[model samples]
Target: MTRTRKAMVLGAAALVSALTLAGCSPAAQNDDSSNATTYTQDEIDKALSTPTELTFWTWVPDVQKEVDLFEAKYPNIKVTVVNTTGGTQQYPKLRAAIKAGEGAPDVAQIEYQYLSSFRQTGSLSDLTQFGADEHKSDYVDWIWNQVADDKGVWAVPQDSGPMGNLYRTDIWAAAGLEGPPSTWDEFAEQAAEIRSKTDSYIADLPGNDPGQMMGLFWQAGAKPFSYDGDKTVSINLNSPEATKVVAFWQDLIQKDLVATDPDFADEWYQGLARGKYASWQVAAWGPLFLQGTAKDTSGLWNAAKLPQWNAGEDVSGNWGGSTDAVLAGSDNQIAAYELAKFINTDEESALLLANDQFLFPTTTATLKNPDFVDQESEFYGGQKVNEFFAGVSTTVDKDFQWLPFMDFVYSSYNETVGAAISDKADMVSALDDWQNAVQEYATQQGFTVQ
Candidate 1:
């Protein structure tokens, strides 16, 4: 999602030189140039005689089907895909590629979290001038907003991870709870009862993972930043809603009602499978991970709405997912736009939905499709998970935007906050350190930190 822009700069310089030379020639520069450049059917046929090759980089496992389809449709265009390895490593690699000025790929999969950072680099092509406007109505407003810069649209939203609670039904039943808790209070009560009655903890609080905690804050209507146009104003992390939410999470751990585990280890996956943890606060992608990690648990798991902040409706959170962006230096801008449109629009919705790709399509028409509504999954006892996810998607807020420094901030916050949860640091000091570290990082990244 992030690029160095060194390659883009060099490419721009070369283009400027070419344009300048062409302009100097009397025959090359003329008022009738636009008219003369129009390609006839014969000319178009000649152009298609030689295929254009494009390189695509993506992290999504479901992208293969789309790639195959695209190759089939445009035999003249060769599409080569490279799978991304790590989420954090993606941006840095992109940055380095741009710096090297030679290894940059034609198209890259960019996650929503890193979109702001990518846009700030000014290396991505704005698809608006190249026919993206025609498909504007096809995507959700919020998803479109994620890719739009002040100049124009930067990417196509391929998919999103709508929030949900994936829990073990057997564990809830054992705790004397009939169904998933609807409110935070009910969730807390159930957690307490579950802890007292059963050996399994209600959830695992991996202190290093700030995603669940951030989700809790957003569900309580707290935002880390407020934007007016392009300017951003930092919001108080100690706001009443944030404090209450933090306290709720802290109290669960402090009261021994939730299992505190180390982040990203064999123990975490093993614990989840053995029902040492009862539920997970995750997005639609949770089922995919569960399918691989908890295969033995089979029919024991089910999906539910995330717990509301104070027993109200409309409670959900956005998590990890990638979008596609075209580079500004691309020679085949029109071709790139066409491919982007094909994936994000209605063309691939059925395949995306059927594959359990966790792609909650942004297009409203795609949502209205019977294929989306009638979709059934054997994973959750054939309960029509897509319908449940569609309901959650409506609550996503357009105003919620991530900061360019989110990666830096979140990385530091997790470390500091994790220490606090592990009893190695106090909450007040940890939060103070987290804020100071983020501000310093922002400064280092050339931001005017206040």
Candidate 2:
């Protein structure tokens, strides 16, 4: 069946009254009668005694294995797994379920990009009372902060899409470059050399992707938006840092050293597989897409740290990733928290890495484990890819924050800014239009846009 149909079917089966409990903490399930306000153990036992079931929604392929394990350990608790389709479709379903008030999943996987929006809508449960306090020591401070608000926590840290550069060794070798470039200047020099020495392009720059520009801007410490708990501030896209990033990309295109692909289509995928482009900027989960789309280039690919800015330190940034959150309305909040905690912590992280090659857990302890260091990936020339990623994860900046109107900002920015890159519009004009559009869109969404 189609992915959407599967999601609908699972959502239907898991929406029954007994399974309709909203958000609570994993600790709530273990509480005694004395702490009944927080869902004491007696209440959970009574609820479970009657064969309580929970619905879980996720898009990650690795989560299925964990669900199977969770089921085996708790045979009495039934779980229905729903795999949501595109982000555009998934959010509406969640919104509808929240509105209906009785059919939402006990837990749902949400992207970091949407955390602020979800929290604003009051769809998630406060996890602070669920015992996240004690376990907070186990996670990275930045990750914990990602899901927490002034009131309480919304979700447990799952995986991180720590950014890196994936390159084709063969392509670099053919271009007479010794290795991947380490700094922005070096990268530009090498790209020019590669174009001059060979027929292949250095990389595929999707002109329509503001996210790519955002990553570059982030490397220079520019944030699209900032929050002061009560108000949001917009960073000017015409700022020097943003201009530098856009200028560099424009030069690359003008020099004809990079291919200006509109999006990740068959042509782009095939080009990567055939070594037409030497490298691409990606995050931890990107390997999965490469594995599925470029099966033929198994051992040719390898990953390295992204090139540093001319004046910045050589640190990595994050791209895209999802986190798991318990619903405020879930009846089995305690049980759900337990599952969320286990999956996000060190032990389950190692298991996830071993089982699915793509997941890079955010827990520092998991990264330090021998299993993480020793594991080898055949797809990456038998490299201990996880170990390298683990070493880099610690240095990733946690200060990078997401805004409530990120979806609207990114969608509009990409389309407009992308037009400039494609030579369809003037850069200044495009950016001005983008900024105005974002302000208007955010205002419509009830956000105080500047």
Candidate 3:
């Protein structure tokens, strides 16, 4: 899970300011190429060497260790790290600053889902002009796409949250099961067995969790959303592929094989510690979190890739992660880009991000490094937790996209799909409600919906 629940942004005042700043977004996307004014290596070198200060806003604690590496390489550059009170409140402040034409950081932390919301307000820079493309091969392909498009590279991927299954091995043994199920059909069978044998439910699904739902849909190859770097969007929440996934969850929930519990809450923590849930359909960050909350259950746990729609497939989706993006309006674009790139690509700095900040690694070097991935976790019965997740990162689909008004898309899920799940209503038909709500909102926001 992310630091915050992708916290409430686009509040009333922020929304009004965003409206005031309308047309600054996609309509002017042509500025991407027009502003792609080439820069020589010497220019970038000079910019980094010159005395400059870059303000960076992020909530990652002790990120200064990584930033220090950047400053050491370019002694002339100093960076000020500001805590934006976490991701939930960060975007509103970011929007307000952009509206005032001041106080915005040179480099800022932005989540993949909210990147387009910022793009919709023309708040992010086209990092393509800063040679961001040169490092394209360094990051996982799917995550790289989240920050780059045909128009420009918006950010350098710092980390990712590939989905996986963290289960109680002892619980499986109690149910006479070998291990995690390889397919959805097998998962249901195991869920039933696990329930009959113990007090534990198979897993907990949060009715309020849009991130988890979106990730699962992504794994199933549901193209529910797309944007054209402009006002045009395609919203297809009711697609058959996505509906099938939801329908399966609906079946499990109604059958009492799964518990509809509010996750990341005190009760959920208790559930894990008390062995009330047999497994957690969690992201890469989850095992570590479980280690913290379920410390007593350490030796009893193991993790695996998410159960595939097909028996033999290895596929997953992402839930939480963030990136460093330069502001489009910052005068120090060159220096800012250098700072962003160094913090993520430099092996030492990047590893510090994973090891210290507890952010998952996105760079291929860190993902492959034995030192990073091969650490056996006693908490996981000596499983190489990072290695398992790093493998899951490779299986993530490369083509998932987000709608610009993701805040609404998420909130709408709470009203329609989430509500339906909580009510134990028809999950497949809830997609129709979700689709209609999204399309209606998209049209109202002046988007050309497809």
Candidate 4:
């Protein structure tokens, strides 16, 4: 799940500040030749050798280990690491700094959903100018598209969270199930059996996680939100595809086959330990998180593909992951880009990010490396968790897109659709409320709602 930062409902004053700051930043004047800018090996070496200090903003703990590798390679370059909090707290501060034309970091951690939001401000530097395209084939396609577009490459893919199912084998066995469900119809039958025989709910569908719910929509090929990278966007949250997804969950919830609980809380954590949840319909990060939070469950669990809407279709979506992006206002673009690229692509740094930090691998080299993916996890009965997730990552759709106002989009879900889930009310009506609320917000933000 995308971590929610604590903040009161953003008022109109804050929205106005953001809108004004977005408009005030200078637009990049790009020529055809500018888009094709590339650095030769000698030129890159020269730039890395020059004395420079790059300020990087991120919340990943102990990322200094990766930065140190970059510094070791380019002894003349020093990076100042700053944890300006994450998404919610960081965006306002970054916007203020950009408006003041001072104090913004040279590089920052930006999640895929928010890339377009930052791009709207005209603040992110085009990384294609720094030769980012040269490494395009190194990353997973969905992740590469998150940071690059027809306009420019915005950042390098650092990590990703492809959706999958992590379930308890023991629970399914007790329910007389032979294997994981391949289709949603089979999943519903298993959910009913598990609840009746094993006394365990199939999963905890969070009452508040729009990102997770949206990931399911994505897996079903619902193009609910689309942005044109300009002022025009298409918002269709209540589409037929979206309704089918919601209705299926509504049936399960109403039948008591699934638990409606807030995730990432102590209660949810305890649910895993106590065997209250039979499975978690979560992202690639869920396996590692489960190992850390519910160590007692050790050998009882296993990984599988998400239950398909169409029996044989292989498809999934992302929930949480981020990239390191350089700002347009940075005077040290070349040095900053080098620092961003080094930590994610260099063998030593990439391995550290995967094994040490437990961020899912994005680079194909790291994904294929046996040392990275074949290692046994004691928590999952020596299962090669990374290998399973790496295989699942290949099923993610490459064409999914996001609206620029994801912050608002998510918060609105918690207020409207999430509220409905908690009340066990009509979810179809809730979807309509969500659609209207999003459309109104987009229009208010000066976006031409399509």
lDDT for each candidate structure? 0.70, 0.71, 0.87, 0.86
Q: How many clashes in each structure? A: 1, 14, 0, 1
Regions of model 3 farther than 4 Å from truth: 1-34
Better by lDDT, candidate 4 or 1:
4
TM-score of candidate 2 on Cα atoms, chains taken together: 0.84
Provide the lDDT at 32 for model 1: 26
* Model 2 Cα RMSD, 1 decimal: 9.1
- Model number with the top lDDT: 3
**Model 4, which residues run further than 4 Å from truth?**
1-36, 39-43
- The residue-by-residue lDDT of candidate 3 on 10-127, one tens digit each, is 1333554565588443333333433555566777888888899899999888888888888888899989999886777898898899999999999999999989988988888888
List TM-score per model, in order. Answer: 0.84, 0.84, 0.91, 0.91
TM-score of 3: 0.91
Model 2 lDDT per residue over 223-261, tens place:
666544345545466667667767676778877878887
- Runs of candidate 1 exceeding 4 Å displacement: 1-50, 149-151, 226-236, 353-358
> How many residue pairs clash in model 4?
1
Q: Return the lDDT, model 4, position 275.
A: 90
lDDT assessment of candidate 1:
0.70
Q: Highest TM-score: give the candidate number.
A: 3
